[model samples]
Target: MKPRLHSQLDVNGEAFAANREQLLAQLATVEAVGRHQQTSAETKREKYAQRGMLLPRERLSLLLDPGSPFVEIGALAGYKMYDDKDGSGAGGGCIAGIGFIEGVACMVRVDNYAIKGGTISPAGMEKALRLQTIALENKLPFVTLAQSGGANLLYANEIFAPGGRGFANQARMSAAGIPQITVVHGSATAGGAYQPALSDYVVLIKNQATMYLAGPPLLKAATGEIATDEALGGSDIHASAGTGDYVADDDAQGIAMARAIVSSLNWSSLLADIKQDIPAPSYSPEELVGVIPANTKTPFDAREVIARLVDKSEFLEFKAGFDNQTLCGHGQLYGEPVGIITNNGPITAQGANKAAQFIQLCEQSGTPLLFLHNTTGFMVGTHAEQSGIIKHGAKMIQAVANATVPKISIVMGGSYGAGNYAMCGRGFDPRFIFAWPNSRTAVMGGAQAGKVLRIVTEAKMGAASDAAMLEKLESDTAAFVDDASTALACTARLWDDGIIDPRHTRDLLGLLFHLCKHADKVTTRTNQFGVARL
Candidate 1:
């Protein structure tokens, strides 16, 4: 493999500066929304301080190893949904990410109790399910900082049925030999009580933690039996009753005990030693911001991105002359071999065939696949149709769906129509998927959608169609589609794992590859049923 030249993107050009500015402005909007959510959670800091409890984020910081990077997922979930008239209720009332605890990588979930008593919303439940899927796939331990008022009654109807899946995932993870540790810092009544009870190890704070099927008021109302919270399911009572594995005096102590438990698991001993002295990419990752054009319709070489992501700007292009629009290549990211599939333009019949062959070859070699999505859709014209686009496109989708290797996707630009499925969108269950701040994912482009609707309406109305009304209809539809297909909007509904900064793409990919490799190397003990308390 030879090093690729980086002459295509002129970093000093006016176009580069303009693109950088636009991308930065878009990134700033996302950052502002996340900061607003953080501030809303912090508003109750004084209230928690008065009660001798640390804030949700504070507990997370103490639980994680010092100086470990936390790759947060779903930071902007449920934005402006349900009771969130303002956009401050993002993150779905929880903080979740993958980070190192006691030098062992684990999926950490902390309920944002300061906000709405850490109530779970519909989007919150979706986010949790996605997190669980990630943990299961990566074979990571699950650690939850449990403290919640249970499901938000406002959306109980929507969350009740699917909520059981979370508990089921907990049981399956434990049965599969993935450790689940929970630290209950406060209220865990009703449905929330099962979260700690199902865990392999539970840490309860003496006076602050409470986990019970029914609270005092509910107990009294249901059975006419008056009982205090402490007598019902307090930390001291649970410790004696064998429900809790450890009891602590405060939030900080509980976190310490949880960390100690993780250390005692000796999980890090199973991991392969980290590689040293890996070569950095020749181009600066900062150039990624400018590589994407400010105009969505502009065409750029996908190799420009591959040049800056692969180690030392080296890549072995596969079938370079077969179909230029669909690039297939082999590259090394952080010394791990990867087969990359990215779109430079629409997926033509030839491009689809080329991609399908490349996918099969990668699977044969047992190499992981990386997809960088930017296609408008499959080529759509009489010529393309005559060339067997549908037949060839289905083959590509089948290859993507069945390939056993770890599939990771980054939606860098337009991911429209069947192009999304072919490129491994959220539906195909890529091990992990992320989107750039400027990316868009929809059935089709807004302008194309508007035109299609107008044509259909005009055909139905025939000679009675009003020119002005049709024009307004087209414009309104276009505007709505564009607004709804933005990166922020897609992330709010849990479309992608989360929207990420373009500059961090390489590092994030490196981490994900490491995790997938570790999961493949390690073996887990499986049983017929999960661990249960006696």
Candidate 2:
């Protein structure tokens, strides 16, 4: 056994103080956005109450087991997106997370009907797709407190194509023996009708819930047939006509039915008993707020982060002397074995090669992998090119893509260019990915992008180098690039799952690790086809 790495960090130093302050400011912005999304205006609340419906969150609370944690994913998904001028529609009209219902851990998704009738925005659709993927991968039961008004027509083109995949995923999940329960609290019209239809169990609230291919207006126009919503598609009709599994009197009753259904399924018995007596990490998680550099361009050791996350601050360094830039090692996260890959600097050829080998070793051992991204990118220079950094980086990327182990990623700081790809930023399909409030992700730094644009423009124009115009162009480009690379912007576009407070990183990773480990061990009964409405 190797001696544990000692931290030489000065927690009370000026640099640490500065970094903490900067991180707090970033965290404040994230919290403010989350608060706006959660709490609606007084008038809106009153209006929602009058409709005889429980708010999206109220339904979720009632459905979840008492005193259980709900790890909400992408809470501020569509922050300031498409007519969301006030930033109140942060979750893209959906609240999704893993939560316990009847002591069974299930994927819970609720449509925030209080906001824009729970319309699916581009980001909302993406979040839905991501949630479905998570459920499928984890073998977790899927539950939805569905009450959406279908797609936001303004972005229907973007939503229509990928939206179909959501239905397909649900169908496949059902075939794989993953139970899907949907409690339709309100309208599920047009394309949205398939959500409950595809689920294994459908709980519809009487009078309030409706599922139809076309509503009365569209029906009248299309077939000259005038009918009330009740006659066309109502909870009563669905229950009596066999379209719904259960019909309840109200929102509360519907949620109760869903809970009872989950409880009866005996879902929890499938998962192996998790070892709960795990030791806590030796370091204080609060130090995470100060570990990252105050300036985006400044460099800091990622080991400081690993020291705070892993159990007892212990990490067995793999290929320690071979490549310092790409740090790969084995460690215990909440007592479960894991392989961690993080960045100390831009990856060089040697670093990429090291990561590739490390990834294969973890896969062979069936250990889950975690990636902590804080790199400028793969090294780029004449020297790096000659050293075959490109091919080496490609090998690492290939290994990440093919590794059977559950891969989780956290973007702690700069995730630029190939670095983002190498670190499992969205494209690599990490089972879960999150970002720190201060994280920056883009192809390159704003300054570098601006300089490149300027150089290219000047070269193309030959002799038309107007200093004042060029200066304006460079600054404008830089400003836009900087804005686009922010944590808020990236999260809004679903670049990562969601932003988290730096201090919660260890706990979040632990929870996710448990879920992933459970998924890997549990087996499900599958059939040739999904349950269908025959």
Candidate 3:
């Protein structure tokens, strides 16, 4: 029989209150950055209204089924980078997420034309590539609300080469039978013209949408030819020439046409019916905000987290007597069976062996794996080395890497060194990875890294080592590592999917589990060549 975990937390204690307050502050910071992007886009609301066009978000709302959840991806991309002097250009000049359109879950990418004319920055390109990968892997239909100004000419040197990969991905997706539907709401000139052209279905807005390989000036410069945007590649021209499948009078109608196209594909028929009645965890998910201490150095039982996440607070622990530092168990999350792996301390040799065996068992059962990371790393020292920590750690990593089951990771606290890899971190290709506001990821803690560097430098300097120089070096290195390992910094570089609130963790996992389940059940028709507009 499975055992129900008992609560050991002191909800009314001072420590819990302190931790909750700190986490709330961190969440506020993340929300504030999101608001900056919204404000930046809203600054152009009047202009969009004057043109009789919906705002980027408005179009997204209309495109998605009413009241459906939208899980935004890469919200902090390009935060305070490139030409963005302030933090306003946070969303990488676009909004992309997974949402339901006509009851069919789809990967939706909408260019934030309100910000910088929806220019494609380097970060924006990376975000788009990541989105395409998710759609391809999950077998979700791709929907793009295209209106970008193409590559930002200022960074054309950096963008000109890699930009071609976007078009290639589009073609590959089409050939893989993943429907790519694009609604061109505005100008798509230069390289941007290929976005709609490569889609399996294209919707163009009448006077507002203009798609061409070159605008007037560029055409005149290259071939001494002058042509207006409408005359070159407008909706009327594209519809007549067979480039666009549908033409709408405005943005709203274009979105409606895209929805109709998605409905016509009948994508929802592929989703397996989920009829199980899921019971909520006995403990409230809200308590998760206080489970991990604000000062990550403080230790808490990993079971506390699992109790609040799994159904009925029940877990069947694997090898409970063999190791205590590494916790491995089986539990049902949102009525879906999952193998839960978490850490209570640095991984010892015995813990690695236990986890490796547990992973294999889960694989044999075809259950999905969930990794909750919060470890310093594998144990190190003369004793650990003598005990074959290296060999055991490698075995654990090997199991994680070769496991064919769906893996999802949440960096709840510190994730350092080999521990990250063994726990299916981003590098291990967890189907979806997220971090909490207080989480930190790095090779090692800043202080530990600084001391290691100091020791190495002292040995290299021999007896002539300068103590003052070493102190400064250690301090600077520590500061840099700490800053770079922050959740904000890691997310800006697309390290994880996004930083999520602890309170919403269970719900997010539920959605991801559903998507992965659907992907495993659906089959697609493929061809050597993608559908082409001839």
Candidate 4:
């Protein structure tokens, strides 16, 4: 007689996989009918939904390409069998491996809570390491949804050490060449955030996930520090503090955003040198008269201007929420590629820092840059300083200065102070500079100057003592301070290249770029030969 075969061992192998698939399909049919139970299930599902967490199979359906091949690593990782006879299910912490995103193979991990609290088991940890390593070796991107209770709380003292697999894998992820993306879907309090930190980019769903270097329970008891997860690391903390790059409202949105971001990338090195188009500057922007607003102080969406100026609907925005003051992204000019930096016309420190990065990315990509300047100035007061504006503000200046791309500046209004310098001021070396006819430029506006003089005069001689003396001071001071105006005085010496009609902006920019393409300075540059030299 043939040797006795165990049912759990997939004794028939290939035939067993075929039988399992057929059985799963049948089970899915039953689930489609009346299998889902009681009214309380909705409440349970809602609880998970509120945390932006979804069932593993549902998440898999949302992530993978239709009918694409997927190889699951650590398929039977965490066997919670009381004995080998009880090993009916497995895969602890997560199911990870190679799958396709938009039909392109990619590295991905899906947290599975069926086996454990999504805590990394020895087998699961090996799988995660394998997937991450595979992503780097193949040069594909990595994406993982982490929702573990952490450290297999049941593992006890063995995993409790300071130097273990957790620390080792984090260092590996950091040095790996592939781009890694992660979303925090559950507790994520222990090593979860560090994993994403090791990755190139991180996305946190709002108010649902918590991230920490060391968990709160351990911290409070170990040290006297009383801190909640949000104070340690939450959406608000990460976004506002620049610790996290993207924040999504839910898991679906986070995944969608990642999909969009991944699709936009060229899957190459340094995160630059790729271009996305914007609506070309075709429609007469006189249409935007209502769009931009008469009162420059009134905020109008800069994306509208971007929409009108780029090739229809090609303005791909990045880091949109981090800095509300400026709008930055990449788009094509006519058919040629260029980067855009427009002041959202909001005065905020976050906006300034982004404006700086936009400048730098443009230079690195060898792509040209266009600035639509309508800045009032920096956010003011002690509240602003507390936001680290000064530190980021200075960094913005350096980024702008170091940018070597062919930059064109189009001043909208009030491009003043360091705002002007940061937003392609003549000092920043833009290739061509133009302002709309309605714009008023200055280092500091004339009103601010007048106010300063008034304060000084009032201090020197009381307001009661002012008559002819105040009148002379007013006339003389106004004329001298008119030096701040962005007029013939500013443009006569090539400080600006004169104003242009918005309707012709596309053609004008395209022509300028083509000219600059053949410009004497660019042809001799190393960036022209590509990043290989660097």
Candidate 5:
């Protein structure tokens, strides 16, 4: 009796149409979830086999947006393992995809740790190369989270890994113009080391990561060199040897490092610049001296000096450890943002290179540039020569010259040598150059000048007592740079636009932008706006 009355709920047949559409969405969603779960489970098994490796797809889930859809390349790579009982691991050999880092489009490759100890398979190589090709074509940054078992030893008989290039393409992909980041969340030994070397940057974990062309066993067998794994390819080794650029503690840390790099590149600049306001200096230029110390030789932290002088102390520092002699960062004054570069203790070649990178960051970001001049000279020694000091120093000068932003030169301290040039001195094309009353412009500092003068004095007073001649030389060199002030150098030759107080830095910077000429970017990137972090 009850079943007869229901009539299959046909009373609202018309309503069923709208209900059908509503349920269709839910039904599709459910089906997708079901399929996704099933595929994910199969993927795990495919990646691991007997070893229980996690496929790139699963790793992407761990590394990228939750439940984000990814399109993979080289998903069907394989090797001799395909003929074995287990068959080749998933993605066949490669791990390539477009997914979301957070919610933005990001390219990623996750080494399948479950398969063959997550070694680079033939398919993996093809997938990586294919992904790199796609990234360059699409102008997207590539992030590779690599953790592999050296190489697929089982395929030694094969000419190449089943997927593609053995390991040579990693270097090729790196040079192809797209920013590639190699993140070592775990071991990346032997052939695996090549990827990070070719990348624009690399992020490595603490103890969990190792990246070396050869492990200790090979080194011991070939060269009788018994070395610890850490000594072979640790974070400190690469970063110090100039192989790795950045270091991280874990997967999260590696991801953060990648994010920070993305921020430093092209995206954050636009975000910061497009806004009408930038950090501005709150003080006057005349008050600059108060923020700085009077003694030239006394050691003081430039960071402290910067904090005391800028409108607001908030500034982003990049590679602070690498360049102790020079520093660059971002800060705001009067709500307007500006790029700041400062020199310290004795300018070394390393400092110069860091300075150049800083200058490029500023120029590329469209942020106004400011110079806090201080230098003895370019590091002139054997150490300087070996560190590619000349090249990096050139980069600094070139970066300044190439910059089109409003530049304000603040001679906060000494300006010596091409150090003056490096600091956006006369020729770097800063919109205008200024000097503090205390700034002493010279090619070399008084101490440095005294060394040269000592020889002259010694020669002149060849027969005289050494003490008397040395005293005169010291007196003369002491005031030489001091005499070379802004008025004497800048006003005398019209090299400088004006002089201002240390406090008035922000006002002058704002005014400089308000006055200087500007141009559209002249970078190699095409229409791509820039890559941003997740």
Candidate 6:
């Protein structure tokens, strides 16, 4: 395969400079939100120190191998929900990432007990379930630094039913030959006790860890039996009564024990050694900041972005001239073979058929598929409608939905309408989906939606409304849709993993592809049923 030619891209032009500046501004907004959440956690640092407890992040730092990268997920999960003042309560009361522990990749989750006692919000529940799903799919060992107050009772109705699935996933993972190591850093009471109980290994922090179905207050109220915290479900009792596998002196010791447990699992033995002699792209990664237009309306070749991401800037364009709007090609990221599908414009019937054929080829070869979303959607109007777009568009969607290989999506710009579905949006369950800070996702463009609604309203009213009222309706609808489709709004609801900086796109994709490759080599021993406690 020859190295791609992105000579057509004007990397040094004024438009590129403007785009870079705009991307930076958007990146700053997303990063600032993450920092705010961290600051919120920091507010309790002094209090935690007074109690001889480590902050959640401090524990996480010690848990991961020193100098290893931690790719944090859902950093802005709950930006402004449930008593979160000043938009500081991000991450939904948890810190989670894929990081190395004793040189083994593990999914590490820490309950940010500093914030609202690490109560699980609706978003927090969603994050927890998603993390479990990732660990299951990637065959990564699961490790959690537990200190949560359990599901927020205020939103119990919202969380109660779905929350049970988290425990179910843990149970199934254990039975599927996946190891789970949990460190009880603080309170893991009530429903939280199931987390450690279901784990293959549990480490309790002496004098600090608590794990019980019901705490002292609830025990007292229900049974009229007053008891101390330790008596009901203390570290001593759990360790002596078989509820905990190991007991540690404090948070540091507990984390050390968890790392040791992971090291002992022989998890590395299951993975085949993969040599990654990947070459850097011919283009500088810094140029990525400018490749994407500041405005969604402007168009740029997706190849320009791909040039800076793939190894050696090499790409074998599948059918370059057949359907230019839909770009599909074969490339290597970190020396791992992958099929790339990116949109340059709306998906015409030809484009849809092109992508459908590309997806099938990738699936047949067992290559992972990467979707770079930037389409308004499938083409519309008379010509597009007559072109059998609906027929071929459905074919593309079917290919995306049913691809056997790992599928990942990155919402780079306008991800609207059926284009989002065909391009492997969150709805299609791509193995992982991420969005750039400048990304926008909606059923349709805001202005288009407003116009559609206005037209329908005028027809129903059967009369021309006052100019001022019609104007207000159109303006209000457009404003609402625009706000709703913003990257921040999508991220707060966990639409994608996290709004990532454009410059880091290559690094993230490489990491993900590496993980998926490792997962492909792993084979899990399975049972008909998950393990259950007596």
lDDT of 6 by residue, 1-534 (tens): 765756477887999999999999999988888787778788889988987899888998999888876788888887777666677778888999789988888898999898889998999999999899889999999999999999889899999998999988887898888888899988888789999999889899999998888888899889999888888889999888888989999889889999899888777632234445668898988888898887768898888888888988999998888988999999988788989999899999999999999999998889999999999999999999999999999999999999989999999888999999999998898889999999999999789888888888877777656667777788899999999899998888888888888888888888888888888787777775654444
Off by over 4 Å in 6: 269-276, 528-534
Best by TM-score: 1
Q: Candidate 5: where is the Cα deviation over 4 Å?
A: 1-287, 308-312, 333-336, 456-474, 477-481, 485-490, 517-534
CA lDDT of 233 in candidate 1?
A: 88
lDDT of 3 by residue, 1-534 (tens): 479999999999999999999999988999899988898788898988998888899999999998888889888888877887787777787999999988888999999988888897888888888899899989999999998888888888988888788889999999998999999999999788888999999999999999888888899999999899899988999999898999998899999999999999867642345436788898999999998898878999999999999889999999999989999999988878899999999999999999999999989999999999999999999999999999999999999999999999999999999999989988898888999999989999999989989999999999999999999999999999999898888888778989999999988888888788889887888998888987
Find the number of clashing residue pairs for candidate 5.
39
What are the per-residue Cα lDDT tens digits for candidate 5 across 1-534?
Answer: 000111122223554344334334433432343244336446557434443334445556666667654544334334223332333454433355665564444567777664455655444444455565445544456788888775467654442544335244444444444567777767777667766665667787776678887789989999998999888887788777777677776566677777677655552121123335544323223333343444456554566556644554566776778977787777764455677888776667778777777777776877777787777668788988898878888877787787777677766667778888888876665545665545567767666677778877788878784887697877688667555442323323334433344445555455334323211221234323222221
For residue 399, model 4's alpha carbon misses the true position, in angstroms, by: 0.6
Over 1-534, each residue of candidate 1 has an lDDT whose tens digit, in order, gives: 664746488999999999899999999999999888789878889988999999999999999989877889998889888887788878887999999998888999999988888898999999999999998998888999999988889999999999999999999999998889999999999889999998999999999899899999999999999998888889988999899999999999999999999998767532244567889888988799999899999988888889889889888888889988999999999999999999999999999999999999999999999999999999999999999999999999999999999999999999999999999999999999999999999999899889999999999999999999999999999999999999999999998989899999999999888888888876878786788899
| Model 1: colliding residue pairs | none
Which of candidates 2 and 4 is the stronger one according to TM-score?
Answer: 2
Q: Which stretches of candidate 2 lie over 4 Å from their true place?
A: 269-272
Q: What's the distance in Å from true for residue 421, model 3?
A: 1.1
Best lDDT goes to which candidate? 1
TM-score of each: 0.98, 0.97, 0.97, 0.43, 0.41, 0.97
The models' CA-based lDDT, in order, is 0.91, 0.89, 0.90, 0.60, 0.58, 0.87
What's the lDDT for residue 279 in model 2? 71
RMSD for each of the candidates: 1.2, 1.5, 1.6, 29.5, 27.8, 1.6
lDDT of 3 at 31: 88
Candidate that beats the other on TM-score, 1 or 3, i.e. the better one: 1
